[model samples]
Target: MMNFSLPMIFSFFMVLCGLWSFVKYHKHLLNSLLSLEFMMLGVFWLMGLQLTSVGMEIYFSLFFLTLAACEGALGLSLLIYVVRSHGNDYFSSFNLLSC
Candidate 1:
């Protein structure tokens, strides 16, 4: 069946990684952020697999990859700032909204 294809396998792996990241996030900010990225990658791959046209699918995949890169860059920059301010990246220490 089509469900047993490579794309499905990869997508399943992505979900598993995302779940692991979410679980790890409670203990570390970096882990959570990376987990979010893992989930995004799954979405990107699925989007590419949904289309039938090879040319169009490639374009969509490229677009998704670009978005993913942007996300990683922004997340990394934010992480850098947070680490500089707190000397570490931990979810429990984040209380900017508690004022």
Candidate 2:
């Protein structure tokens, strides 16, 4: 009998989504951001599922969520600038904007 724990499943989602974010990150900006958010959410979910101490998890999740929101905001702003300046959303094109 192969029984999968909830935390284990969530952890797999975290790793898989994290890998996906890194693999395609240099190709498309929007897709990469979405995948990164997915990975972050997976981390939040796993923390909720696997924590032994409710108090610790609550504080950790609060801090993590705050950081995630800041990251998402910065990513979205860069995405907007990339799209407006390049007239496209590819990561390579955005890199050209810096030079």
Best by TM-score: 2
Which lDDT value does model 2 have at 5?
86
lDDT (C-alpha, whole model) for all candidates: 0.80, 0.77
Poorest 10 consecutive residues of model 1 by lDDT? 48-57
For each candidate, give its TM-score against the true structure: 0.75, 0.75
lDDT of 1 by residue, 1-99 (tens): 454678767887897889886886668778877898889889777777766423453776788789899989999999998898887998678787853
For candidate 1, give the lDDT of residue 61: 75
Candidate 2 C-alpha lDDT tens digits along 1-99: 756686768687786978777686758888888888888888877776655434553777778889999999999999998788889887655564465
In model 2, residue pairs whose N, Cα or C atoms come closer than 3 Å (at least 3 residues apart or on different chains), thus clashing, are none
* Candidate with the greatest lDDT versus the true structure: 1
